[model samples]
Target: MTAAAPAPRTPRRRGRPSRTQTETGPATRDRILEAAREEFSERGYEKTSVRGIAKTAGVDSALVHHYFGTKEQVFEAAIEVAFAPALDAPAALEEGPLDGVGERLTRFILGIWENPATRTPLLAIVRSAVNNETAAAVFRRLVAAQLLRRIAGALDVPDGELRAELAAAQLVGIAMLRYVIKVEPLASADPEQIVRRVAPVVQAHLTGH
Candidate 1:
């Protein structure tokens, strides 16, 4: 038989190959994070593990460690993603007159929880936070650093941080009652009505009026 022509060889890229198969792209990192969130949500922070997250993500535990370092780090990253939307609270505070800051913030925050698109992951983070101190620390650090501190800086008051925290307390209480705990009329009340009622309290916290 006559010899067939050989297939052409493909050239390899110049850079060193990644050490881990899962290190290829941001997609894998995001996959790990999503898996971590689901794991944390279902198991709570106390019970969730890097191995569990890796299994859920279809990656090696070493890969999860490579991406996030530890379960706490993974949990922090997951909370960061879940809380990303609400981090814009500072922008809402600065968007308009300081006098109306409370209502604007209240409306903006509640709007996020009301939207089904955002609520699911947020619920996961909130549940994990309420049940676990470690998870709570992660949530608090991000909120305090990225959300509350920014809002406080906008006000320039000596007690700005405290006020920001108070506003957060008011908004968080509403979220707990209406969304997490699902208590009574507050849960079923019109969004507009809740906005009207709660905004004033939030406003008083932020502006001291």
Candidate 2:
């Protein structure tokens, strides 16, 4: 029989196309983070492992380590994602009059928890803080570095660091007790009412009111 003609062979590109299965790194990272938040919130820090986070994200456990070195790192990143608005508010405040900084900050914090979008993560953080000292350190570092420090820097005053820490402690403590711990009255109280009552207290800490 006559030899059949060979099928055409297409030349390959100089380099291999990306081996990555994910189309977008940032989007995948965000999904991983969101999944981590949900898992951490639902399971609590001690029970939520890197493998669990990865499974929730539908990615390999190694990817979690690739993106975020450790469980602590993942938790920190998740916290930052959860609190981005509040963390960024101080910089936003700088663009406007500083007179209403306290009110704005109070509203921002309450708004985060009142909204289901942020409430889940915030609850996770509170649960972690109450259950684990290491988790609390992670929470404190994120808040102090991202929110408190910047706010303190915005206002020139003595003991700004202390004021910032105190303000954060009050807000976080209230959130933990009322929301996470389900403290009576505070837990049932309307968020707006709480804001009105607590904002002034936080304002005093921030601005010496």
**All candidates' lDDT scores?**
0.87, 0.79
Give the Cα error of residue 65 in candidate 1, in Å. 0.3
Q: Give a tens-digit lDDT track for model 1, residues 107-207.
A: 99999999988998889888888998988999889999999999999877779999999999989988999999999988899999999888889888988
What's the lDDT for residue 38 in model 1? 88
CA lDDT, candidate 2, residue 178: 74
Which residue pairs collide in model 2, if any? none
lDDT of 2 by residue, 1-209 (tens): 99999999776444222336335588879989989998988998899999899899988777777788789999989877876767766775566555666667777777777788778777778788779988989987887787778888987678988887887788878777776778898988888888888877887887787
Give residue 165's error in model 2 in angstroms: 1.7
Clashing pairs in 1: none
Best prediction by TM-score = 1
Evaluated at residue 51, the lDDT of candidate 1 is 84
Q: In model 2, which runs have C-alpha deviations exceeding 4 angstroms?
A: 1-24, 92-99
lDDT of 1: 0.87
lDDT, model 2, position 190: 87
